[model samples]
Target chain A: MKLSLGPLLYFWERDVVQSFYQSISKSPVDIVYLGEAVCSKRRNLKLDDWLIIADMLDAAGKEVVLTSLALFEAESELGLLKRICGNGRYPVEANDMAAVSLLEDQSPFIVGPHINTYNPSTLALLSESGARRWVMPVELGGETLKQLQQARPDNIETEVFVYGRLPLAFSARCYTARAQNLPKDHCQFCCASYPDGLLLKTRDARSFLTLNGIQTQSASIYNLIYQVPELVSLGVDVLRISPQSEGTLETIDAFYHAMHSEVNGNRKPIEDWQIVDYEFCNGYWYGQEGMLWKRTDEYKNLESALNR
Target chain B: MAITPVGMKRITPELVCPAGSLPALKSAVENGADCVYIGFRDGTNARNFPGLNFSTDEARQAVDYAHDANAKLFLALNTYPKPDQWQAGVRAIDLAAQLKVDALIVADPGLMRYASQNYPELRLHLSVQGSATNHLALDYYKRHFNIQRAVLPRVLSLSQVRRVALEAPVEIEVFGFGSLCIMVEGRCALSSYVTGKSPNASGVCSPAEAVRWEKQGDHLCSRLNGVLIDEFSEHEQAGYPTLCKGRYRVNDSVYYALEEPTSLNVLEILPELMQIGVSAIKVEGRQRSPAYVAGVTRTLRSAIDACINNPEEYQVQPSWMRDLDKVAEGQCHTLGAYHRPWQ
Candidate 1:
């Protein structure tokens, strides 16, 4: 299975973002998506900057995709979506039906996770419209993926979220701005401070979620490294790793090593391979609760097969 | 034996009102509401806030009282459940069914399946949390899951509503007042990502505890989870802290990335809605005071009578309908998705 680096969901300095992609272009990740998929107001990097990075990654022998914002409030945003559709250099990931309507028969676009592909018929309709690839939401796993993939149109690429916090929702309301005591129209870009995202806890203080602009995410960094073998068995075309502020490169390298090796040293098993120090949970991928993880001998064998 | 001559009866659309408290329930029934929707105070329901919803004893008594007064009672079991809470939610649904709720408004398919299998006799209405904006999702619920009604999402236009009502077998309950959610309900992930508790899974969104009203020299700041969304001076009106209507700063300027604070005013369009085949008119706020419920229901009930009676003058916004400030969001109102041209 190939690895695809998801777009940067957080706001970083422009130089920081560019440098992050510089390293990504050289990494083992086969496909790299570019653009801001969240709040449209996050403008640390514009479309040109994303295009520059996309060109660099494409030169580095990687496929690049431009993603549209999940929520659009005005005509200007729609105009930009039209412009992105006409960019021609790369495919656009349509997150909303409006974008899908725009891409019908015009180009081979990607049906994004937010596009609501819960069943076979919806998948068939989108694929017939022009979807060459599709990404299952983080909540869906191997079992659900197989169902969608079975009814998938001929040659539809299937990718799944394998790492990083799961994006739960997008809205016009900015929770961070609200937390900062400002309305969404006058928000001061306060979300820029936390490069990763602010942790949200239950009143009892359980770390349960994270806030990034208008988008909400799972507190746990979903890691599916152990399920790579299951992924291979299912013939998933790509594994997506969402961008994180720190240690993402290390995580990428660990995935690379595991993807190419049956065992790390001492035959300790590839499933036992610790990719970064983040807490690992494969429950969603395994059709268990998202918070559950299984580390057994079988899981070890599964990991070994994935890495090899 | 009593035998009566058949009398012509004009069918009045059922007015569904929200009862945040017991007193509100009594006031709603007293003010001629055909039905009332409520929930247990826990996270089992969508309006799962502290000091809101109802206790078990209160819910049972409320049901009895509403039935005694010739009104129906609905229990909202709309929030999505985590794996751990699924059993508890099922228990709650079963209990409500046993209490003889007129119907249960639920969103999750798995939970709906549970209700269908375990308590087949219970009435089920798809909650707005189901986000059945398109017909197919609603058709799935009606044909296979056996939902009797569906509360349509707020993102649809009137023509879309007509199409949906015409196609689906279930009755359609629409929002007539309160906060207008800009995003598609149940399908939204924004609140859960920021606050941990989701409107879908946990039954809360842009929760009040996470909100802060910070006052600067002249402007009052409203923040949710420490993210600044809006600022108002002493001159501007204060609205609730909801994520979608908040503002954001991009580049050097701040803009309204979502929607502005506004109440949904479909009162003027009631005749159009009815003409389009809406089965029921639902007022959205169940969290407001009892007085607000009485006022809204009284005005709307009068308006519905006039519309079905005389259609000409009813086409205009009512002179008394403007008195809806006590129950509106942002102290202002709009036609919402019906007026997407303004959006």
Candidate 2:
């Protein structure tokens, strides 16, 4: 399976983002998705900059895909959609159907996770219309993946969201703007301040969810570091790692080790790869409680006993 | 346009009912529901309350009983799965496929995909929890997943819904009665931020456990996860402490923070919705009792009949529904979202 870097869902200084991707160009990831997947107000890189960066990544021997904004709230957003899909330079990930309809029947594209591609018939329909690969919706597990893969049309690659904070929902109203006490239309890009996102904790401070612009994401970062074998067995062709602000290099390296182990299946756990938080959950990957980490020795030892 | 007995058939608006319990399901079906929708007791469905939804055996039997009486049963697998809940969600789909349900109302695209893959023959209704707010998202689900019916978000006007229905591929279901969700369904994160569970992720919204009502001297203070949303005096009625419905202090005085404590009643607007090609009218009360179920269903069923029997006699008035609030949560009612003046 190939390691694909999903789009950056956060905003940062142009130089900071540039430096981060510059370092990533040297990483082991084979596919890199670029573009702002959140609030369109974050213009860290314009069309020209993104094109130049895409060219740079391609020169570095990586497959580059451009992403469209998740929520298209304005008419100008529609204009941007046409520009992105019509760029005609690289594969586009259709976050919404407007983008899909633009690319469908005309070009080969990757079906983004949020498009709701359920059932073999729908997959077949989109595949016939020229979807080369599809990232399974984020919340789906291995059993469903296996079923979809079995029924998936020929030559369409299956991808899964392997790591990062899960994008749970998007809306017309910006929670980030609301937090800053501004109406969505007149708000002056306040989401730019929070590098990761504005984390809203319960009064109990349980580290609940992250509010980014118009998107609501899971508070716990999803790390599928341990489920490499299961993903491989399910015939997943690409693993999309959604970009994060911190520990990204570590994430790439850990996924490297895990994917290597998955590919070869004859190795101990990667010792050099430091897990920032094993609080690191693979529960969603393993078909367990999403917040539960299964690799904890207590649980692993119990598994060993159950096997015995 | 004039109606006559010469017309081939009079279209009766569908009386869609909720089934939080088996008894409620039977009551709704017996009373007047042409179709009933239920969910598994787990977080697989959006209404994941303690005593609501059905167990596995109960779901199987409920479908059987609904079918025997010539009514359809729609199973709601509406909550997005936590990575761990995926397998269990698919298990629910497999069971539904085996049972041959009339439809599966799905909220999550992932869940929609799982059901579509596992059971190609089963009908698919897009749950409002899918939050397909516009024609684009609506058509995508309709075209790709072959969603046979769509429970639209409570954020559109009757005209916008008409335009969408014209462009959308399947049936359109609108909420005719229930608590008015001011915010878009499936996209709300307010409750989850203040609590560990989110409605989109955990099949709950502003969970009951987080709500606490206290007597603070002369006022009744309702707090949700410790946020003082409302303080009601003895003269006023206290409502459910949903994040959207709570009263909060904007400047100095306390007010209805997000929305006034009013439940949704679109009975007056039912003809307007039906004229706009609304296929099904939903009455939302998954946590309601069987008596309430019987009463609401019977009333809506008769209302649908009344409209068909005489279009000139069809009029929507608040007086049409007198005691619905006595049994309603939050103790008030309005035509939420469907009516623009709700703002």
Candidate 3:
């Protein structure tokens, strides 16, 4: 299985983004998804800047794919999509149907997680339309992925979002701006302050969600590091690690080691890779609440015990 | 209000309303609905609430009753199905076709392909869960599955709705009145992030099983799976525990950072919608009571007729607005994304 770095879903300084990719170029990640997948107003890294980084990553023997925005409401956003699709060099991850419509039959592209490819028929149709690989919708459990893998066409690759905060929803209104009592049109780039995202807490003071402009994300980081062997056995082709503002390289290293150990048949448990101020959740993979972490082995043991 | 010329021709858009049960279907059709949309008592549709949808037998009866009243019956199989549950969705589609409903409102591409392949003559309307906001996305579904109509998500402004309606290859439908969803449909997973179920995956949002209501001091707090969604003071009324409409702490202050628990009312823009060639108007409350369905259907029917018959004098009646507000989410209504100021 190959490790792919998912696109940056947060706003960061241009220099910080450039340096982050510079370090990733030398990392163990085989494929890197670049470009903005959130608000279009996040212009710290323009298309040209992303292309420069893509070239640098390509020179470092890394495959690069560009990602489009998840929610678009303007003609200018569509114009940007056209330019991204017409880049003529790298594969584009179609996050919305508009991106898929633009990239269909033009070149081989990736179906991003937000495109709603949940079953075999959708997979077949997309594969016919020149999709090389399709990311699993984030909300689907592992049982669903297993069934899809069994029925997926041989030509299409399957990628799963295995790390980082799960992007839960997108809206026309910007919550980060709303948090500061600002409208979306004049957001003042407030999202740049919280490089990860503005954490949303419940009235009981429990961390619940992350507000990143128009995108709402999970407060708990989705950690499928322990399920690498299970994913490989299920024929998952790529495991995607979404980039964060900090400690992304360490997260990539942990996943790389886990996958390598599984392949070598000398598996070692991942240790000392926990980032401060982040909670881990693997429940969505187990068909449980997404914010709850359920150990697969423990769950199986409990199930058998209950049967007895 | 401007009055229409006496000799002018007016094209009235179809008034589509939701029906959660046989009685609701009959009430909606009897009241004034030109079409009634429903889902089976299963997870195949987005309104998979318990005790809220029709059984297969009930659906068959609904078809006959709606057809008898010259009302079209649309079966909604709009949720995205996983491979394990794919056959159940297919069975629902077959049942819908066997019942000879007017159309199938669907979201999943896989189900759309299956329906078009097996039931070629059955008309297909893209569900709002399909989230086709632009013409190109509509064209994608039209080219692939030959969809006859597409419902626009509530995220678009009135101008954007007009642009798509003018350019889309298929007929267009817009939300007329109902509970407002702040997030884009189908794409939102906020419910599943806290709970295990989602509208796209499980055909429900903020599942009732996970919801808990408790009184803390003088406030009533609503929690979903132990996560506090909102708290209301004694003077304030409590709404459903949808994650988007919840109050949360974003920075230093606590408020309804995403949206207030209000409903969407578009009666004031009926003229703009009609002028833009919108083919139908949808009322979104299959989980609502039969009385709610009847009242809303009747009010929208009268408003639509008044607009069509006397376009120049198409004033929004205060009574109509008040009737809609009484059944609205927060006892209040906004234009939602249709008005530019809200966005």
Candidate 4:
């Protein structure tokens, strides 16, 4: 299975973003999705700047796809969307219906995970509209993906978000701004301070969510490294690894090695990829609570016996 | 307030209300709702509560009762059903068609396609859960599924709503009053992240089964799937443990880091909504009581009528606001995303 780097969902300094992609250009990921999928006000990277990075990634033997904003409340955002769709070079991953409406009947495009492609009929409808690949919606389980894979169109590719903090929700209200007692219009670019997003914990001190500007993400990173073999067996074409502030390259390396080892018939120890300190969850893949960490069948018996 | 003396004006917007049960449906229609929308008794719609929503028999009676009152009955098949439940959604669409409901409010593109292709005559209204925040998105739904109307999620400002209303190919509906969804509908998975059930797939948010309430001495604690949502002191009235509305510690401070528990009340903006060409005003509560439905419907109905009678001289009455506040989620209201500052 091919590895794709999902779009960066946080706001970062322009230099930080540029250097991050510069390093990503040499990463093991075969496809890269870049652009602001979160807030339009995050203008640290201009359209031209992103185009330059897109060109750089393309030159480095990696296919690049541009992502549109997931939530657009203004007509000004549509102007930017039109430019991205009409870039005439790279494939645009349509995040919202507006982008899909603009990109349809033009060229092959990708339906982003935010577009809510659930069943076969929606997939078929999008496939007819020139969608070449569609990312599975984030919260859906592997069973849903398997069922969709069975009914997937002949020309469509399926991508699953295998690693990252799951983006749980988007709002007009910017939680990052709200956290600082600032209105969204004058948020003061405070989101750049925490490149990984501000952590939100419940009253009882359990880390529950991450406030990334207008997007709310799961505090626990959703890691499906153990499910790579199952995803491959299910015929998923791409595994998307979202970019975090740190250890993204390491995460990519882990997935690359895991996929290769599974092919060699010698599964790697899961402990090898436990480099990140954040809690891991794969419950969404198992059709359970997304925050709950369910061990793989290989270790389930051992863990359950220990619990007993 | 005195009734306006001006002649009845053009395009008095439709007042669409929610009906979770038969009594609520009757209450909505009797209270002067132009259209009453209800979900099926399964995971076919967003409000898939335990006893809420209509069974097939209840739906049939609902259709008759609504039509008898000259109010439209819309069946909400808005949830994005997975492949396993796809057949169930298809059956619900067929059921809506068989009952001769006025329209089918749908969210899933696949289900919309099925409704459009199979039941060509059924009028389709895109649910807010469809998450069409812009006119172009609404146009896509209009072109592909031939949707007659699209409900705008409560994420757009007043100007954005005007732009959409001005340019949208289909009729536009905006929520006027009820519980506020801080996040865009259909796109949100926060509830599912914690509870494994989301509005898109499971047709509920922070489902009640996962909710736990405990009295810890002087404070009442509310938890969703064992995740602490909020804790209320003895003097404070506790709200439902909706994930987004709960207080959380952000940046070393405890507050409503996302949004406070509040209802979105657009009563003050009735004239502006009417002027902006919003075809309908929707009240957002299906899990509420029949009395709440009746009170809210009556309040909004009068508010809309008052605005229509004299768009220039109309004002939001104190009594209407009071009546709506009683049934509101937090007993307080804000213009939500419609007002610029609220965003």
Candidates in order have lDDT scores of 0.74, 0.74, 0.90, 0.90
lDDT of 3 by residue, B157-227 (tens): 88878777766888888999999998899899888888899999899999999999999999999999998
Off by over 4 Å in 4: A270-276, A297-308, B1-10
Best by DockQ: 4
lDDT of 3 by residue, A47-142 (tens): 999999999999999999999998877778889999999999999999999988988989999999999988898999999999999999888889
Q: Using Cα atoms with residue i matched to residue i, what is each candidate's TM-score against the true structure?
A: 0.63, 0.68, 0.95, 0.96
Candidate 2 has an lDDT of 0.74
- Predicted structure with the largest lDDT when compared to the true one: 4
Candidate 4 docking DockQ: 0.86
- Judge the docking of candidate 1 as incorrect, acceptable, medium or high: incorrect
Ranking by TM-score: 4, 3, 2, 1
Please provide, for model 2 over A16-47, each residue's C-alpha lDDT reduced to its tens digit, 9 standing for 90 to 100.
Answer: 88888899999999999998777777787987
Which residue pairs show backbone clashes in model 3? B2-B312, B2-B313, B3-B312, B3-B313
Each candidate's DockQ score against the native complex? 0.09, 0.09, 0.69, 0.86
Q: Flag regions of model 3 displaced more than 4 Å.
A: A274-277, A295-308, B1-11
Shift in Å, residue B130, candidate 4 = 0.3
Candidate 4 local accuracy as lDDT?
0.90
- Per-residue lDDT tens digits of candidate 4, residues B1-343? 1111111234668999999999999999999999999989999999999989888999999999999889999999999989999999999999999999999999999999999999999999999999998988987888898899889999999988888877788888899989999899999998889899999999999999999999899899999999999999988999999989999998789998888888999988888888777778999999999999999998888888888878889988899988888877889899999998888
TM-score of chain A of 2: 0.92
- Candidate no. 4 TM-score: 0.96
In model 1, where do residues sit more than 4 Å from their true spots? Answer: A1-239, A242-255, A258-308, B1-12
